[model samples]
Target: MLPNGKTNLIALDLGIHGDPIKALERIVQIAKSGVDDHVVARELIALSDGRAETRPVLGMFLGGAGLADSILYCRNQIYPLGLSNGLSHFLTAIAVLVSLLFGIRARFLPPSSNPVRISLIRDGELAGRFSVLIVTTLEKLLLGTRTGESQRGNMKLMAVDQSLSALLRLGWASLFRRMGKTKMQGIHLEQGDTIRIEGDHSSVILDGELFEASEGHPIVLRSTQPVPFLRLAA
Candidate 1:
């Protein structure tokens, strides 16, 4: 029985399903009481299981006297689990090293940005709008017309007047090709750059060309069509 009168079964279930590291992080984030104390207590409990008894000994050795003093009363209190101690220490060290390596890798990964915004007007009046973000690169890929499957590596964006149509195409491609296309269009963009529509309707498109007002910095659309063309600003 726990101090809260809950059975060990509950604790076992929680330990098995919940991530200890995440829970500890949440406790620290919330500025809760006895964070260090809770961590030490949970660590002691986790190490006492029949299959994990060697953890306490490994923690004591790796943590050193200072950590042990902060968490426990004396070094003599931590007992090794006989022959299992050597194997357990080796496994623990390997796990710690692997976690550190993954952390470093994650830091170098590319960051994802929010999609661009656009307003939708229908019949010369304001209608609903939508937004979308890019998840992959912009490239041309040939796909089968009948099966709607990629025959080669020719995946490209589809042009549509309505934002919903673009979203539908993306959803279809995701269902069939196992991937989604990036939206590319909206305010203050550059040539060959991709932009996402973020308003009411969600979609993604790529920029073929851009024209800025020379004197007043006003946005000028060369054409309301998606095509590879050149435009010189006046």
Candidate 2:
């Protein structure tokens, strides 16, 4: 039940380690309560549980400690909407490295006739929305480390490189197609920004772990409570 008013504020003690899906369900319930009640869920969020491929890649450009916080801060405050300059350049570097590695790895896989359409939205904006044909979609291929079907069970290290590479190619193609028609957008992450990935049922690799998600059940990513990260003069 929700409190009576134009806005309802509810706090849940989801525990130190809680399930995100359950929390999302609770928020959904509050949203559906009364037409007049406005629900806003606010709290401090930490970085993901463990380290991911992106971590090392980020650490390569930036530093390991507080890496996510650094990326979030930079992307939010410094970078622009398109092409991305300043700190957002890290994302471009990551994308390039990821694409190159994946292209090399792609030769080993079989080709497929049907391609899937994957839409990547950043901060409620279409950054890179594309439909590409390949043996396995980039998202799937990156998350491939999680499944035994990929025959890469012990292959833990290459997740970031492979995933980012495939994603870069896809996003680049999308950018070219969107050029002249609309403003070309690239993937940029920032603090307080929410990334919604809808369509195509699959898992996303974060901090070297697989987060299973499905179509319509989009995964929303946000960062809170900036930590002491990527400090150079330590």
Per-model TM-score, in order, reads 0.18, 0.28
- The lDDT values for all models are 0.24, 0.28
Show model 1 residue runs off by greater than 4 Å.
1-107, 123-234
- Residue-level lDDT tens digits of model 1 in 52-169: 2233111100111111121121112222333343454344333323433353222222112112232112212111221222111122221311213321222222222223344445
> lDDT per residue, candidate 2, 32-104, as tens digits?
6642344222222222322243331111001111122223333444354454353355663443344344543
TM-score of 2: 0.28
Instruction: Give the Cα-based TM-score of candidate 1 against the true structure.
Output: 0.18
